[model samples]
Every structure is written in C-alpha cells, then in structure tokens.
Target: MSLKPSSRDWQRAIADARQGLSAWHVWNLLAMTDIRQRYKRSRVGPFWITLSMAAFVGGIGLVYSTLFKQDIRTYLPYLAVNYVVWTLIQGIIMDATGVFSSSGVYLRQEAMPKTLFAMRLIMRNLIMFAHNIIIIPLVFLLFGVWPDWEMLLAIPGMIMLLVAAYPVVMLIGMISTRFRDTPVIIQNVLQIAFFLTPIMWKVDQLGAAAPFVVGLNPFAIFLRIVAEPMNGRAPSLWTWGVAILVIVLLYAITGPLFARLRARIVYWL
Candidate 1:
C-alpha cells in the first residue's frame, strides 16, 4: 500500500547486504564460474581478454597518435590506462542492468541475498579487469614509461571504485529487472557516454569546454581518479572531492530505494 521503506525493511536490506558480503565464497564461486564458462575450451582461458585489449590499445594507439599528431610513446600509455579503466567501468555497468534478471532462477528458487549477485557481478568484471591490466606493465616497458610516486594514489582510487560498485550495481539491477527495456536504453546511453568521455582524447584538447564536460560527467570524474594516477599524474583535488561526492550521493539514493524494493524485486523477475 505504501511506497516508503519501513524501519523493518531498512533493517532487512542492511542485513541482506551484511550477509551477502560475509558469504564471499559463494559469490566468488559464481563469479569464477562465469569467467570459466565464458571462455570455456579456449587455449588461454581469460587471457583472451588481455590479448584483445592489447590489440585494441596497439591498433588504436597507433592510429590515434598519428591522427592527433601526438608522440606514440606518450599517446600509447595514455590510451592504455584510460581504456583499461574505462573497460572496467563500462563492463560492470553493462552487465549490472541485467544482473538480477539473469540470475532469476536462483533467486526464484530459494531465499538468496540480492546483494550477493551484485558482488558476483563486480567480482566477475574485476577478474576481466585483472586480465586486461596485464597489458599495462607491458605497455610501460615497451614505451619506456616510468612510474611516479603519484601512481601510488591509484590504490585509493581503486578502493573507491570497488566501494562505488555495490550500490550502483544493486540499484541498476533492481530497476532493470523491474523494467526490461531499461537495459536497452542504458546500453545506447553508454555508447554515447563512451564518446562523451575523454578516453581516447586528452581533456585539454577540449579547451574552453573541458571544465564543464568533466564537471558534469561522473564517468570522466571517476575515470580520472584512477587513470590519471596510473598515467603518472595525481588527479586534482577537485576531482577527488567530486568522486567522493558522487559515491555519497549514490549510496544516499540507493539505500532507501533498495530498502523499499528489495522484497518486491523477486516478484518483478
């Protein structure tokens, strides 16, 4: 009758999350199984992810370097960090919209914590990200790139990424499971976002429009937090401020919405 999340509902949501997190072995198994099934019978298993990313970086780095008239050494590493970070971001979100519905059979059969599926999704993408990141060290070696102390900041940046993933995946998974078409719409928007984000181009190239673009685009903001540190530059303080703000806002919004809908979600699927 009422749409508000009652105190009991909020407690249940929190408990579900706490329990889901504590059950790491279950989610890890599910995540690893996903990777194995996806690459089954392949010669190198998930290394295919690394090889494909390497090809894209090499091919695009060469072509875009000439197009932008930038030096290959500089451009290639730049592209590698940005593209790899972007892949992790894009991959989680792309799969998140379908996470719950895809696992409907499991959810429908028994009592399962919804947050576990969210964790499973994050873990799966992280594995692919690990594979994809193999190219980074190789790129650094090939391009003679040296690490800077600033690169250490990427550790916190990565932690922030994982922290942000749980809520975002849970929120999107809930909504898309309720409304199937939401996934299609999100898929198209992500395609546009890929270009709007400065993955292949330096933000400086935007000149007068750079500030507005970065300020408004959360993708660019989060991307900078991780990629800039890896690229040997510390992100500006404002970027960190914005990223923390986005994480706060995401939890703020999803916490209540998830509490309200957590019970209803199974029916929707």
Candidate 2:
C-alpha cells in the first residue's frame, strides 16, 4: 500500500470533520480524559484554578478599583465577570495552536477527524471555565448584585462565542502544525489583544474614541454579549449583529483553507 491519501481522502477528511460533531461520545470522553489527566494526583484538582482565579480577581479588583476611583461594590463583580470570560477566550485561542500538534500520538494511531481534537481542546477549557466560574456567584452575592431576566441573554451570547471560536481554532491549529513558530506569534498577538480589548477597564473610559476602539474589536463585542446581560442590561442589537458578522467573516476566510489543509495536518505534525 502506498499510504498516501488521495484527493478523495481529503474530501473524506472534511466530511469526517463534520461527522465528528455527531460523535459526541468520542470527543466528550477524550475531553474528560484530558481534564482528568491534567489534574490527576493533585490535591485540590481543578479547584486550584478556581482558587487562583479568585485570588487574582480579588487582587486586581482591589488595586484597580482604587486607581480608577470606582466603588468596590460595583467594580469587583464587573472585574470578576470580565476576567472569567476573558480567561475562556484567551485559553481557547492559545490552546488552539496545539490542537493538532499535541495530539500527534492519537492521530498516527487511529483514523480520527481533526475536528475531534479541536472539540476536545475546547471542552477541556470549558471544564476549567466551569471550575473558575464558581467565583462569579460569590462575587455577585458579596456585592449584592442581583441579575435580572436580562441575564438569560448570556446563553445566546455564549453560543455565539463558541460558534465563532470553532473556525479560528481550525485555522490556527492547521497553521501552527505547519510552522513551529506560529504558537509563539499567536501568544504575542493575544497579549496585545488583551489590552486592546476592554476587559480590565470600562470602554467608556476611552471617551469619544471608545466607539471606534470597541467597534473594531470582535472580542469586545463578544464580551459585551455575555457581560452586559450579567450587568443587568441586555447588549444592544448592534453588538449581536457585529458579533455574528465577525463570525461569518472568520468562517469565510478559514473554511477553504481548513478544507485544503485538513488531511495534511498529520504530515506537518
């Protein structure tokens, strides 16, 4: 046997990727295993992340509240929510770089869809996100911030976020597998994006420039979709529209590239 995959193999790879979504049990098991192995033999397990997140949020909230001259009652909860969501966004993007490369063993051993690895990565982070998010309710209670019905809007907001993140993960995973340096570059870009996006500070602080700054950042728009609802107000329709538009644009650019590169991933890895 030649062992070289043909054009039909590439098409099947793409088709398998789509089919992988329905193979929920496979990815879900792999994701859970990843989480377990990560925290195995650790005393506190994943709660360590939750504890560290609480401490970091508390420390930052205190200093920033003082510096920004904002009341702790309001500011801490805002900071907590922003940090949690930002952590999820940052983790997903950064980890996407390794979705293929790190799973080289499984790829070589079994006929698996690349999308399965992506889902496993996302699910692992979501598990960690679940652990870190317990602090949110605590912050809400401590600050006496009661979210209203508007908070339900966060459901759709989170759905939009995950939907947008999928293509980015695929694109980055493919590129990073090919270029060893891509992960480092992605980390640097994410660091810059962190400050550019409104996470630690309010967008309004930028004055008239706020609109221009926030308008260009899909991260900011996605953040607003979730954060605004928790803040007791629904995000504007325009924000939702912009987030969907960004998702569409990302898919448009990445879809063809991913199709071309899907089967070649193992070779690069």
Candidate 3:
C-alpha cells in the first residue's frame, strides 16, 4: 500500500513557512526559537558556548603565546578576534551541513519551504556568534590594544561577509541533505581546512606563501577581507573584489537550482 499522501497534507507545511516569511517576523521568530531550543534544559543556557570559547582562547593563547615568545596581552587580542570570527565561519559551515539534515523530520512531518529551515540555521549561528563576540572587547581591555580607525570598517565588512556566506550555506545544505555522507565528508575536510587557514596565526607568517594561499583558498580570502580591516590594516582591494565576485557568482548559480530542486529534497532525505 502507498503511504504518501495525495497532496494537501504535504503542501501545508511548506506554505506555512513561506507565508511566515512574508512579514520577516515569523522567519526571525523561527530562527530565534531554534536558538533557544539549542540551550533549553541547560543550566547555563547559551553561556556554555561563551565560557568554553573563553577557556579555549585563554588556554591556547597563553600556551601558544608563551611558546612563540609573543606577549600574552597582544597575542590574546589577536587570538580572541581570530577565534571569534573563525568560530562564526567554522560554525556556520559545519552546522549548515546539517541544516537540512536536522530539519528532515520537520520537513517530513510539515510542509515548510525548506529554505526557511536553512535560513533558521544561519540565524541560529549568527546569534551565538554575537554572544561569542563578547570575547573581543574583553581581550581589548585586558591588552589595552587600540586599533586604528580601521576598526570601524568591521561594520560594513561583517555585513559583506554575511551576505557572502548565504550561497555557501544554501549550496551545502541542499546537497548534504541529498547525500547522507556529505556532512561527514565536509566535517573532515573543514577540519583540515581550518588548520591550513590562518585562524590561529597571521597569514603573513607564511611569508612568500601568503599570496599563493590567498589566491587558492576562498576561505582564507573571506576571512582576510572580513577580519583584516578590524585589525588595523586594510586588505588589498583586489581581495575584496574577488571575495564579492565569488559571492555573487555562487549565489546566482545556486539560487535557481535550489528552487528547482527544493521539492525533490524531501524525497532524498
């Protein structure tokens, strides 16, 4: 006997999520609700992420700073900012893989636009990321490191980064749902990519290899454009150009394909 419903039941959830997006309020609420659910029943709420992050940077910063013979105060701020941005980058890329995976049951039981779940995944990370950012000002205060006026550049830079991340998030989330093994593969690869990128150190430390690194690694390029300006240095205009170009191209390429395949996504899961 066939188990699939005729039509109406399957369509309702998708319609609800879509209609909910109309006001932007429901979409934001869905995203916020997901964030809250992540901390539910936890004694510390979301502070766990913050506290763990603090310990991570402090412990590692002290060890590495001492080993490298760099002063703890200076190194701490660098590590803090780097870790914070890297946390956002790594978290989004890693969590995005399962945006669809985690939402599979929801999709099967309800008819939400599928994209709403993906957006919610992004939003959830964005919120925790904000919490984690508290690490930065603390580092600045402890270090007395005064950034150049370039620090103001973070406002626009971050806006650009978030806009740029959408394509990566959408493309990965959709594909990972279709291929059950994808999330695992991405996780393994990203772990390697993280070490290779300059999350814990300055890319310039690579010396002659820095240019080649930037040319070949989109993740590094993204991090550089977004983080450099805040560190009191302006990234090369060419790098920003390339980052934005890649973002626009990826979004254009993935946008329609996602819409076309959005329905089939449910079956794949």
Candidate 4:
C-alpha cells in the first residue's frame, strides 16, 4: 500500500534539503553565472573588470598621489585595494537594496527562491571583486612589492569579512524593499562616503583629521576587520573573533525576521 506524506512532513523535507545545500556552493555557482552573464557579448569577458580597475588605479594613482605628494609605489596599491573593497561594499549595499525590485518579475511569477536572488547579488559582486583582484598582484609586481607572512593573514581575515558582510546585506535588502526611495538616497550617501572614507591615503597620514576618520566612521570600523591584514599587517585575533561573533548574531537574529517578512515582500512590490 502506498501512503501519502502529511503537510508537515513535506515542509520538513524541503527545509532539510535547503539547509543541506551550502551557502558557499550556492555562492560559487551563482558568482560564476553572474560573471558569464556580465561578459556575455564582450570579447575580453570578465577581464573587463580587471582592465577597468587597472585604468582607474593607474589614472587615479597618477593624479591623486601627485596631488597628495606621495610616492606612487606606496600610494597606487593602497588606492587600488581600497577602491576595490569600497566598490564591493557599494555593490553589496545597492544590490541588496534593489534585490526585491530587480527580481520583481521572478518573485511574482516564478517558484525560484528569493534568498537565492540576494545570494546571487552577493556572489556576483564577489566574482567581480575577484576579477578586479588581478590588479593587486600586477600592481605589486610593477611596484616590486612582495607579500610577506603578514599578507597571508589576509586570507582568513577576508573570509571573516565576507561572512560578516552577508547577513548585513540580506538585512539591508529586506528593509529597502519596503522603502522605494532608499536606492536614490543610498546613491547620494555612497558618494559622500567615498570621500569620507580613506581610500588613497592612510588615516594616520590624514594628520589631525585621523581621529574623526578612525573613531566615527562606520566604514573604518568595517575595514579594521580586513584591511590591516590585507595591507600586510597581521590582524588581531580579538578583532577577527569579534567580527565572526557579529556575523553569528546577525544571522541568528535576522534569519527568522527575514523569513517572516519574506512572504510579505511580494505584496509590498
């Protein structure tokens, strides 16, 4: 005799299967697809991100370091790394904010996952970010800079940063879906933030303005977790632990909150 499963059993099975599908795996596949789509008609493909980054770094490096009266060797890489990280942050924030709107058709018409859309945005940014990363090594080689053991510390630190960043992205995506004006406001604020945050010059190099830049800046707080290690300084264990802890808290709190609101998102749109 064949038996039919109860409603609860079907729901539980679906949940279990989703839980088993790792976020990392989803991110990797989505990221790859995003890169391919981004370069669909282009000859150079995803290398465009790298090429553009190189031009930006080279162009800005020549102008900014000259204006700042700093050496290009030291300043160029700093500018490149900072700009890459800043771009990724902006992409994540903006992408999350528009996740619902951008995927409105799919959300309304299809059975495809909502969380996957957000994940895809993050993954897409990461893939582009990785492509841009090629500029780092090229710059390093041109400048004759070498990564010491301290630089190796950046791998784990960046991993921590990515983990900490996702839930924040998801939360922003959910909140912005409820507020249509958020995207425009975010664009203006991001422009202001670009100037406010230190990209080309070190905070310490900013002289008296250093304290305000360090203590009050949210981007500074976020960068502290990853930038130091990336720039060849070993990140503190305490800082890494704190960043990871924050990630855990964000997931634990936002997961259920987002889930409850997930179904209502379509109505809002």
The top-ranked prediction according to TM-score is: 1
Native-structure RMSD, model 4: 6.1
Which of candidates 3 and 4 is the stronger one according to lDDT?
A: 3
| Best of the candidates, lDDT | 1
The lowest-lDDT stretch of 10 consecutive residues in candidate 4 is 1-10
> Could you tell me which residue pairs clash in candidate 2?
none
What digit string (tens of lDDT, one per residue) describes model 4 on residues 1-269? 12344555446434632642355576567668767877899999988778877898899999999999988888897787778777777778777788777778767896555666667777788878887878888888888888877777667767766766667666777778888888888888888887887777777777898767654665654566556656776655655655666778888766665655655677777
lDDT (Cα, 0-100) at 52 in candidate 2: 92
Poorest 10 consecutive residues by lDDT, candidate 1: 213-222
Write candidate 3's Cα lDDT for 16-66 as tens digits: 345634636655787788777878999988889999999999999989887
Tens digit per residue, CA lDDT, model 1, 1-269: 67689999999999999999999999999999999999899899999878888999999999999999999999999999999999999999989999999899899999999999999999999999999998999999998998989999999999999899888899899889988898998899899989989899999999999999876799998899899999999999899998999999999989999999999899998
Q: How high is the CA lDDT of each candidate model? A: 0.93, 0.87, 0.77, 0.72
lDDT of 4: 0.72
Error of 3 at 171 (Å): 0.9
State TM-scores per candidate: 0.98, 0.94, 0.87, 0.82
The list of candidate 4 runs beyond 4 A from truth reads 1-30, 110-112, 236-253
TM-score head-to-head 2 vs 4, winner: 2
Candidates sorted by TM-score, best first: 1, 2, 3, 4
